[model samples]
Target: MSNKDEAITIVSNFLEASMAPDPELAATYMAADVRITFTGGRAMASPQAITDFNSGRYAWVKKALGPFDWTEHEDHTVVYSNGTLYGEWPDGRPFAGNRYLDRFEVRNGRITRMDVWNDSAEWLLTPELNQES
Candidate 1:
């Protein structure tokens, strides 16, 4: 496979892993030296770290990421996605949504870096919007 194809496959597999209770597949996509920055000023190196933090949100809130529209731009591939995250929260609150911008940096065939930014605040305020979400 080409570098672009590898990147897409890695990302797709990672996404599948993310939905599972365990994040093993997600970690496979990352290089050991990978660095990631979450929107909340949380920065981590290992893919496991990324999963550890995100798992908290996923524990009770289900996230359905989808409709990923991809564009092959120069040497990079960008995917624009829209999805729904709907599940009951651990605290018994209905926490069921988040919109996001997920960016990946692929080198060779591994993801060396990733940055995630999302409209978490919007979901925090209104769970109902998730229908039209």
Candidate 2:
């Protein structure tokens, strides 16, 4: 497989491990010095940190993965994963269609950087939007 294909597979596998809440497995796909930033500029030190953050914000969450788009550079590959988030909220309310975009920089078969953005904050601010009307 091409480098790009390998990068995508690495990313997909990481996501699966993450949703499984298997931080140890997820960390396998990342570089030792990986940089991760979540929505609202929250800097994360490790996959465990992500799981901790998610624990406070959501009851349980999973991605409704859409597509993987990538761009190749001289040294690394930039991959973008866009999709909607679906799961239950802290209040035990189920929600879906919360759009999310994740950007990753893969080098040497490991992700060196990851940035995440999502619509959960907006939904939280406007609760009616998530309500079944």
TM-score computed on alpha carbons, candidate 2: 0.97
Clashes of each: 1, 0
Q: State the lDDT of candidate 2 residue by residue for 1-133, as single tens digits.
A: 9989999999999999999989999999999999999999999999999999999999999999999999999999999999989999899889988889999999999999999999889888998887531
Cα-based TM-score, every candidate? 0.72, 0.97
Question: lDDT by residue for model 1 over 1-133, one digit each (tens)?
Answer: 8655667777767767766645677777777888788878789766677667665654454457765555665666654445755665444555544567677776666677777776655555665655533
Q: State the local distance difference test value for candidate 2.
A: 0.95
Off by over 4 Å in 2: 131-133
Candidate achieving the largest lDDT = 2
Instruction: Quantify all predictions' global Cα lDDT against the true fold.
Output: 0.65, 0.95
Q: Weakest 10 consecutive residues, lDDT, candidate 1?
A: 88-97
